[model samples]
Target: MEKLHKPKKVFVPGAISPQFIADSIAKHQSKVNIGAHAIFLGQIRADEKAEGFVTGIEYSAYEEMAEQTFHEIREDAFSKFDLICMHIYHSIGLVPTGEISLFVFVSSGHRRAAFEASEYIVEQIKTKVPIFGKELVGPAGEYIWKENK
Candidate 1:
């Protein structure tokens, strides 16, 4: 019997569209016996803070490190959960406020696994990956890096 390999994790230094994520999920279905799929989309929010009105977000990452970290996270999730399939994507460039910045999708034989895995992926990305984003704000265009705090 052939062993099943995990789905490829994609990293692009460009804009991310919802269509791209949907396509990825569709392609992974053959390896999954999914009865439930859960997705989480993180959008750039315009924050009105003490600094000023947030305009957009510009993202950056330590690509090599981020990729390695993501791969490890994927393996951990597969081993820890009963998920059949999963994918995670995050924008690396400028993303306008209200646009999707991160997307996570998970499929499982049942709803509970799907839901829990989806949450786990997002949390891992935020804490483990070297990706960071700067919140562009104010009429004069100031930028501040966003931290987990």
Candidate 2:
């Protein structure tokens, strides 16, 4: 297992690209012990709202606090699950509809642990992290602060 305490870079400037995700998975090919990897991608949706349809999402956060909370969530996941490693990335700026905003990848020796831990990590991030999203709802740039459900 890798070292646990080092803080990882979790924030990307915009949408999480497919190339980035492919590269991440490619890099893990050397870890033969990892039998399964669970990945969760959060994509921005073009949902019709009272104002208009959502065009995109602009994400912002208190960087320091968000990073700390992410680290805490990582630690909790490590302690609670039989994980080999995990990675998480979230968008910081504008992500257009149908683009990825969040990526969560969890690896383990078996499938069940990886799947369950990925779910738990995603739930923790959605509920506990302080990241905020501003939904661009109209063509005229009207927006609303998104609330976590």
Candidate 3:
């Protein structure tokens, strides 16, 4: 987490661009305090349902609540680990299957801390955040509500 900074909007309008991820990593190289970084990218999957295969997902969230929940998650992660920086991004609009949606990156002084913190953030976001998504299926455009199983 950056010091003396306002909270950033986490939701992207569509699939997370690859260039954005690359740029983020590149920016961290100048920070000599960070020894290890862990990244987790959650992609939309083309899951086969009874009706057909999932083509895309449209995500929405309770923005005010989700942001607050994310802030708490970040603070907890920092207390539990020696973290230098952390970033979380989730796609908001339509994301095609196989495209990235959620990205969690954690930087720490050691690999262990980075790995654990990154994993923790991803799991907590999935379970705790009030983000809803619809799975648009097949050519017919049938839709189903998406939930973590």
Please give the RMSD of candidate 3 to the true structure.
Answer: 2.3
| lDDT for position 3 in model 3 | 35
TM-score of each: 0.86, 0.96, 0.94
Give lDDT: candidate 3, residue 41: 95
Q: What is the C-alpha lDDT of each candidate?
A: 0.80, 0.94, 0.89
Clashing pairs in 1: none
Best by lDDT: 2
lDDT of 1 by residue, 2-100 (tens): 224544655765567878877877786686567999999888778896789888888888887888788888888888789877787778888888788
Task: Please give, for residues 80-125, the per-residue lDDT of candidate 3 as tens digits.
Answer: 8889999999999899999999999999999999999998898899
The number of residue pairs in model 3 that clash at the backbone is: 2
Please state the error at residue 112 of candidate 3 in Å.
Answer: 0.1
Error of 1 at 1 (Å): 22
- For 1-149, candidate 2 gives per-residue lDDT tens digits of 34477989899999999999999999999999999999999999998998999999999999999998999999999989999999999999999999999999999999999999999999999999999999999879898998776
CA error at residue 115 for candidate 3, angstroms:
0.6
